[model samples]
Target: MKNKLEIKIILSLCFVTIITAVTAVPLQSAHAFSWPCIDRSDGKAPIAVSDDNVYVAWWGNTTGNYEVMFKASNDGGKTFGDKISLSNSTNGTSVEADVAAFGNNVYITYADNKTGDADAYIRTSNDNGKTFGPEFKLTNNSDSSLTSSSLPQGMKSYDNVKTSPYELKVAAEGDNVYVIATGGDKNDTTYQPDVFIRVSNDSGKTFGKDINLSESKGIVSERTEIGVLGDKVFVTWWDKGSDGTDTPLLRISDDRGQTFGDIIDLSANATDSNTTNTTSS
Candidate 1:
């Protein structure tokens, strides 16, 4: 009788343990929902952040035609303000918008074909993204006609530095701003692209002439990048020379884009040059 009683007691303890375990499990976690910042299609967005402020620049066709659009979030993208059209072009289509931000200053640059030919343009904002200044044209490509000719080699055509049909990037630091692009020479019949740069020391108020960083003709230079650190500027690009081989090159400027030093070949041999090089300050 005692053995049978002990067996019943043990079974009772097992039942109680099973009931406690089932009750100890927590409930399922709630799933997080994704919020749509913009409800438009055909948008090519580029975003930049400065401290708690997040800025986004894109090109969308919500206004009948493609135009540059912008929006800001001061609380780390948790909430975004109303979308604003930065490039409200009436006669042209603005595309491929790029953005850069430093403190209270924000910049948006893109390409437009308002003048029958595509050109680079920029718009700046001082009070974050609340208001923006007037549209500023950055490129003036007057002649882009294709000509036929041939260069024997070791010669570079110094005519017609056209900035269109290629990607352009913008970088800003304090009172200085930079725009790096790939430009083609009108004189070179091969239409080889070269890396060019434009600098603005007064924080986008004014810009200097386009400086050729590649300085090589009949050879293609592309995928240009720029970085600024105080008074120092660094530019890098992938260059394919007459050997038909890709090489990574870099140029440094100590006077804030005023002048660049000699070309510093990142790779000495052709085998070592088939890679992308990036620079950051």
Candidate 2:
């Protein structure tokens, strides 16, 4: 009886060892993991998908300075390539990166305090995010000429309440690319930021002048979103109204962002109302 008991114990131990060995084998495909960056720092990360390709953009102080970083996955999001810095120059602090992709083209837009005040800039990737070209300045609101260090710190909130950082959004389809951002008008003494759009006809190679979409006198808060479907372009954001309540607004472009129609209030009764739009061809 003692011999039989010993044999049973040995057999159980062997089975356990076999199961552990099989489970220890590494997976052939990489899984999604965290991107390392400096401590005590955070920023927005927006993603765009085109078929099986995935593109992601964010800002971090990994290089001891805040920079817009990008990562791409050709095989969906199962694995990602090495991170690339879109704001790879001495262009002050860059943050709030927004990404958009169509076919082989990828677009990234962010705000940089290179000229003292925050201005929107864009970088385009023609090879499906494997490489990026020089950044093009989209807004000229840095007339204040304040020093870079004295620029707005981190992200600005609306009415000192909502803490989400305002995002510079981008949308792309075929050879057309559109970007929307919230920035102050140099001529306005009230200093309230306005939503502006810039259109690119040559697949982000060149962009037209910045056209103000939200001409509201009230403060523009929260992130601005853009969507492109066929020849119609849609944009939405939140702004403070005369009643001291945040209301959602929308503007549509029927001619590929050449001109935008009057602002349409999405919600006038709701306070702190924010909106996002998604459309398909």
lDDT tens digits, residue span 1-281, model 2: 22232332221111100000001222110010011111214466789999999999888776666888899999989999998988874656676678999998998877665554334567888888998988776543312322334333541321111111134678998899887655544344344556666677778766666566666554544357778898899888878766778877788878888777766678754685443342211
TM-score of each: 0.71, 0.69
**lDDT agreement with native, every candidate:** 0.63, 0.59
Q: What lDDT, from 0 to 1, does candidate 1 have?
A: 0.63
RMSD of each: 24.5, 19.6
Distance (Å) between predicted and true CA of 231, model 1?
A: 1.5
Give model 2's TM-score versus the native structure. 0.69
Worst 10 residues of 2 by lDDT: 13-22
The parts of candidate 2 lying over 4 Å away from their true place are 1-42, 114-117, 141-166, 218-222, 268-281
TM-score of 1: 0.71
For candidate 1, write residues 157-249 as lDDT tens digits: 312222233456788888888887665544445556667777777778887655667766677777777777888889899888788799888
